[model samples]
Target: MDAFANRPLSPDLPERHSVHDMLVGAGLRPTRQRLALGELLFRGADRHVTAERLFDEAVAAHLSVSLATVYNTLHQFTDAGLLREIAVDGARVYFDTNVKDHHHFLVEDDGELHDIPGSNVTVANLPTPPKGLRIDRVDVVVRLRREEG
Candidate 1:
């Protein structure tokens, strides 16, 4: 099934909270670049975006933000649990603002990301940790390819 086919195409979603609020909620200082970048990342509908894609979008929108700023903001967001980093491939990293426990399906042909609800997957018993090390998170990325007809 085409994951995006069933998705809604509406444009009137509610605006997200102010950047200052987001920064305060995440326990980070609301710097100028952080404010702008936070608005860009979280103001709209939730999305799975790469840093390169975000840079391009910022430039196209005339937002004069620097690449370093984007990287730094992304790092901060990830550290604060406001964003979830997904390693679809070894090199390319995608950032998702939805921090809920869920999985993703990546279409290899076009780099499309589809969110998989957590309720659909079941987890059984697992092995215990060896020692002081603890389990931080579990992320699942299923890469999809078109099957020959």
Candidate 2:
């Protein structure tokens, strides 16, 4: 199913208002660019996206935002606890709309991500943290590929 189906692109925007309210709740000013970008990011089921992909979507939707703006805004949202930043590898980063604690399945062939419920994974013993340090969070990205026929 299309996750971005039926998104509003007109003047009479209920979703825009909600996105505005969300920005305010997150202690961020609801600028025109933010509202537009937030609407695209938050208007559907939780999913993952890269900055380049989001910028492409914005361009496809005629949103006048630079790629740098998208990157900065994504980092801002992550810092504000509205999104989660997942670094799959050194070169690839995905911004997840679901901020809850959970793992992910990375499809190697297509670069798709699927959420793995936190309850399903178990972390056993771990090496003790060095002095003056503690474990913050555990992020597991299980890579997957189709079996050969």
Q: How many residue pairs clash in each candidate?
A: 0, 0
**Candidate 2 residue-wise lDDT, 1-149, digit = tens:** 22213323323344667677667777788998888888788866787999999999999999999999999999988877778899999999999987777999999999999999988999889889999999977999999998989
- After superposing candidate 2 on the true structure, give the runs of residues whose Cα lies further than 4 Å from its correct spot: 1-14
Estimate the Cα RMSD of every predicted model relative to the unseen true structure. 6.4, 5.8
Clashing pairs in 1: none
lDDT of each: 0.75, 0.83
Candidate 2 similarity to native, TM-score: 0.87
How many backbone overlaps does candidate 2 show? 0
TM-score each candidate. 0.82, 0.87
Overall local distance difference test of candidate 1: 0.75
Cα lDDT tens digits, model 1, 109-144, are 889899989777666676687899887767777889
